[model samples]
Target: MSAPASPQELRKLIAASSWTGPTAGVLDGYQQANLAVVPRDLAFDFLLYCNRNPKPCPVVAVTDPGDPVIRLGRTEADLRTTLPRYRVWQRGELVAEPTDITAYWRDDSVGFLLGCSHTWEGPLRTAGVPVPHAADSMAPPVYVTDRPTHPAGRLSGPLVVSMRALPGHLVARAVEVTARYPTGHGAPVHIGDPAGLGIADLSTPDFGPPPRLEPGTVPMFWACGVTPQLVLPNSGAEYVITHYAGHMFIFDHHVDETP
Candidate 1:
């Protein structure tokens, strides 16, 4: 199926289960985000955690307790069913990956919309930097790095990063292009040598697909929105919900716009 032409249409398609693939190139020029839903008891801690770890968890919109619609910007996005896929967790264990979570929605639930790097792909392409994942129509490989995030209350875990392979010569340009979007993981955390970040093998990632690189190319790593999912297990939260990898909620703002 062809990609949706606008953010609203994309959400509509997602709500109808007509599109379940990664949202990389969909609704270009609009911002995309990762979704995290946690119980109210741990909501403040999770919010503080995101505040501390802004690079990996920059928040775009947050839903009021028990409200599925995010009260941010001008869009009426429904958190429980707008994303193409959702993952349900029970005390850190992934129990189900469903297309909608309305059945699991609770009055005490709070949703967080975190910035996504896919928002930078359009600018990268315009800047003459190649985005391999976009070209291949796949999600970048996301690894659970050895680096630890700042702990807030009971929420703490290792940092997660998404790795993209770019031509060695264009790495600098890629960095420059992405740096302009601070909320979207501003710049890469690591440029080369995945081992430095405790990533043992590029072929094996904690989430998403394996990295694909051409000769004379380097792997560029950026803090990923998936960081919250990694922290959920460590937080010991009895119930949690997150967007399935690469299937994000699209917003109406451009990457540079504050939401």
Candidate 2:
């Protein structure tokens, strides 16, 4: 891994296929995002769902149906092929994972840009908090909680979270630091006792590797951007498109501008 590139450079790298993995550290100072594409007919309800659940879905931009360019973010950005990868869903089932979605682009589809937690890592680091996974060059563990989200017109399901272990004494500081970035998932929803949140075992996260808890450290959970993507299937949408895993849409706005 090398120093992160600027949003514009990272976009070029992704466009050139030089990088095709999780974008956790690719554009350090820029805002990274989750993608959600839905037909125009369902756009209003979906936007309402995001507004109702801002923690899990902070809206950064919403493209006009049929427009591939999101005017709010990088003026020249193209949603179809800017990310390293994308997942395509049809009628609530994941039908394909594609590098590009040019073929699936529809004039009636609207693109939604949502805020992601990656934006808060810098604040944590600046506060002298340790982000073990990013420090060790690894991905953090993520899980689906039994905690159901507020429903809105076919959009409802359990919340999903990403787990990170912090030294017992530093956990409180971590929460405070992250809380300052409300648009980037402010504060943790659950701390300690994963089982209390309906999580079965720390060894088996729904996505990514099992967490490696350090001695005297406890597990901390934060609402994740993935919650919306995971719950979309149950939302009854006939089709949905989202970035695969950590592959995010790099935005032109600064992290503080996310809200």
* Cα lDDT of model 1 by residue, 142-240, tens digit: 899999999999988899998988877899998988888866888999999999999889999988786766788898899988788788765888899
Candidate 2: segments with Cα more than 4 A from true spot: 1-4, 73-75, 257-259
Q: Model 1, which residues run further than 4 Å from truth?
A: none
TM-score of each: 0.93, 0.92
C-alpha lDDT of all candidate models, in order: 0.87, 0.83
Q: For residues 177-239, what per-residue lDDT tens digits would candidate 2 score against the true structure?
A: 888776677889999999988998999999988877678989999988888887776667778
Worst 10 residues of 2 by lDDT: 1-10
Residue-pair clashes per candidate: 0, 0
- lDDT (Cα, 0-100) at 100 in candidate 1: 94
